[model samples]
Target chain A: MNARAIDVRGLNKSFGDRHVVRDVSIAVDTGRITGFLGPNGSGKTTTLRLLCGLLTPDSGEGTVLGMDFRARGDAIKRQTGYMTQKFSLYEDMTLEENLAFVARVHGLDNRRERVEDTLHRLGLFDRRQQLAGALSGGWKQRLALAAATLHQPRLLLLDEPTAGVDPKARREFWDEIHTLAAEGLTVLVSTHYMDEAERCHDIGYILYGRLIARGTADAIIRDSGLVTFLGEGPGIDRAAHLLARADGVLSASAFGAAVHVSGLKREALEAALVPWRKEPFRWSEVPPSLEDVFIQLMGRERDERYTS
Target chain B: MTGSLPRILAVLLKEFTQLRRDRITYAMILVMPVMQLLIFGYAINMDPRHLPAAVLSHDTSTVADSVVAALERTGYVDVRYLPRSDEELDQLIRRGQVMLGITIPPDFTRRLLKGERPQILAEADASDPQAAAGALAAVSVLPTEALRHERLGLGAPRSTAPAFEVVVHRRYNPESRSPFHIVPGLLGIILSMTLVMMTAMAVTRERERGTMETLLSTPATPAEIMVGKLTPYVVVGLVQTVVVLGMARVLFSVPMARTPAGWLALACGIVLFIVGNLSLGYLISTLARSQLQAMQMSMFYMLPSIFLSGFAFPFLGLPPWARVLGEIIPVTHFLRIVRGALLKDQVLADMGNDLLALGLFVLAVAGAALGRSRTTLD
Candidate 1:
């Protein structure tokens, strides 16, 4: 049986008069890699921060790692590791020194061995003496991850962990994350990339400080009630702009030679594309992708935010 | 040809918007100069008056009373204490309670009547030579003024020489070297400037550079972080103190504490003072959002510390309100402790009040810093 690592409810956070996280309730199972997906300023980072004791909820009660997150923040912080979106290590210190500082902060025994093991595990041992600030973006992110997990935390919170990394580095970073999760270390990561989201065991979609969707990637897309039609033909991609304004067509965008048009009603979406159903244009019904569902959710919630 | 004018306007407009948003820098720019002008103009009295004095009179005669009255009438010396003995008078001077001490010898009246040119001794605390210079010069005209006093007309014919000579002794800096007074006090000012600014930028630097978020996420408490950051700077402050003290001794020939216990007291005072400033800097770091803001805040603090701490002027020369402000400043107490130990050879027991003040400052500022330090980003 998979134990619950994070079971939090009614999490609310506000900055000044702006409510950044509103009534966010989430639960993550142990050893699961849960991805938080949202647009900019949609409280994914804030919710992750609230769970890992980096920020206190305006009003929330939860148990993280089987302890009260609010009352046992110090204990939670010790057992939990947090990697911020920005590289937050000491730039002036060497990579080894950065990892060693983290090891010492958590008061780990045999600190030298831990630092050396983490450096080698991250493949940074060769460049251990390089200043963190002097390293490139990929190396810096790798060092930050090594430092975050140096204390062997059971729970990891990564905020946009692979934001600006190259594709190869991002793949390696994900592989390392999976290796850690296989060790029964629960991970909570926030990312904007749909490919990264698909790699997670489950996903949480946040919009306007509210968790509007939560489930596995397949389940979320299945429950979105969105219909999509992919069109293929000469100049059929140009029809996306016109179909996007048609009745009941929520989002329409071209993907190279093909165009994916999504909406709630299949008949209305098909009617919106009726103008391009000529010899040069051929359409087929397709399962709405995760990106299609998210675009629909973002549009629906943003409209609600303004109208309400 | 003038296309760049709008771009210049855009940059100027953006600059003003940012400046308006930074309330601390805005207030510093607007409020600092006015406050400094008012303080420097009204509180800094170079030729000060009503200096506290002590009179130890062995002569129980009308002439001694008239002589004390004459000195008081000069509007420079205020004879506030009548100590019973010379040792008590000397203690008052060393304690910094009195700026001047007068001694009326025995048979002062008889010596004046017999044309013996009796000597009335006047001793001034010359640590602040500026404060003592005017008051000491006032003693020179006392003999002529005493004879002119209608109440005690000594009915002596005017002669080439005055009847009695008022012998003046400038204690501590006998040569009235300004460097002796300035250098030791410079130690306090320099430590206040550097230690406070250095540690003041400590937490803010981390915050500005985005490292504070990771640091706070660890199991380290605010107290641990504060101590870990400031303890190193304490060593730095001590090394700075040794360098400045060595320079003061070797270069300026400034007298240091004679006894080893006195040196120990000075060292203790220095440590307490350094810790107090570092704690104050930590408190500023917790309050400031940016390193620039932290620097501005430290500069704001250092102005009052340098001006009102009696490093730039005599402590007694300031008005009562300014002295009250000076008393609250840690530098003021440290300056007194330093000047007293180095100049008067005072030991630990003699500097109890100032040391206690520094201890209280350290406690209060460190406590405030810990209180202000945020464990969470909120």
Candidate 2:
């Protein structure tokens, strides 16, 4: 079997004068979970939509699930499941009815039996009679998951599926995602949460409609060429705030009693931290964190924007 | 008393902001009454005149000529067609091409000279009796007044009833029952109002609920989804139709399916009407981004259909320009089909042109709806 579930190149989309997704090329291996990490309006959702058949690109070409994505969008849509940012299931319908509606829409065989099995598997059998709108945020997220995955799509795309969900529910949702990935479903989920990105096998960071970073978490942090210095002292909070505004500093924020300052250049970072180094404040060089790398990338992108 | 000025000003400002935000509602509030006034004032004529009348005269005598001439002078009848035979005149009236048809007997002048009253026939297209009422009532005095000078002194009776009497025959509705005109027309208006509004709201509600993205992402084609969305409403329309028709039959005493052919035509017309309106509403939904806009558009369509489609007034009462506008609306043609089939026992062959017009409307809307059901979110 082919390893790549989604392999697209040079995909672009624009609505009116606003160019949303530009030159987005991505390839997801089979059975792997790829997390798209970006801030809101960073082309994560639009790029995800382009990967699935929900949106046609202004100019793009590739195969999705081994079929020509544009020429065979209907065929692609049949095998793929896309969960939108909002809870989009029929609110007036019960859990079972929503699942049944999904089944009926896709023309799945043994619709009733499939719906029943899905309900039972999700532990939603008891409350299947409850309307989707009445469900709490966590339950609504879970129901959206069930509805998206009901057809056993080979590829899944979820755009910020767990935004407002609780921590416990998010863990369960990730666990479900991993289980589905293990079963050979290529899943690409978009979210801003650092933990969610860490949970994925690989991550892609998008900024200004372009994929800026793509790798495992450790690789992304290492490739960012970011350096950090962890300072521990009584007056470090005041020192950290001063350090953040100093030259060559990417970001510096208090993490507790201690403060961490990050920068792209080691010399500039050391020089910036030199002021508070002697007076009851001890500073040690540390490996840059994932959050530090993202901060560095955002600052660099802003610089690139002004320079261009 | 000091704070009241500020409070009232605050409310006025808030109202202006809301009114600006909801432009469609603003337009509806301001535009509806002005349009109603214009339609009622200028377009609507309670007593329709210059009605198209066909004259089928078998008499070649001067008396028949004067009678036909007199009917024209009343200003209610415009003698547009002179048919060769009585059957041709009946055909003209039956097709609703003319409001009335005058048929003079072959021995009309000879019988009147022999002091015998000859019955002159005037057939009225009574589907909309109000249009032909004045013309028929005035036909009784037409002959005596028309022959007043040419009476040959004592030869003719000119004081009261004419020697050659006009025997008015109301073809479709003999007693000119107003219910027959009104009850059948209600079907089209009710179906258009409900079916169009409901379907428009259904699609807009889906978008509002954010379910449209999920629906479009599925394998279900827009055509299939459209069918799924509109299928349930078909049943609703049918039930409503049944309720309205049943009540019309019981309460208003409107006749139901006078012929087997009428039953078939009515059933077919009703089905087409419901689907056509549903498709139109769906088209509106595709254009409307919000539920409020969809509702406003439906009201925009419904109000015009009620006023301008000749449901409230006579179809021929409006000017030629207005009739041209009415021809475009689906309700106008559907009303014709309903009244033509139910009251006049007109078969499909009789209203083929109307059925074709309505069928074309159905196809156009359905095609446009399907086309507007975009697979891509763009």
Q: Which candidate is the best by DockQ?
A: 1
Clashes of each: 0, 0
Question: Residue A164 in candidate 1 has what lDDT?
Answer: 93
| Interface Cα RMSD of candidate 1 | 0.7
Q: Tens-digit lDDT track for model 1 on B1-378?
A: 599999999999999999999998999998899989989898888887888888888987766577778888998888889998988998899889899998999898777777788899999999989888977877877877775553236665556567788888999989999988999999999999999999999999999999999999999998999999999999999999999999999999999999999999999999999999999999999999898999999999988888888899888878889999999999999999999999988889788999999999999999999999978888
Query: Scoring model 1 with DockQ, what do you get?
Result: 0.87
DockQ (Cα-based) for each candidate = 0.87, 0.85
Candidate 2 on B199-237: residue-level lDDT in tens? 998778888899989998988788888898898988999
* Model 1 misplacement above 4 A: A306-308, B1-3, B62-64, B113-115, B150-161
Best by TM-score: 1
Each candidate's chain B TM-score? 0.95, 0.92
Candidate 2 local lDDT, residue A45? 88
TM-score of chain A of 1: 0.97
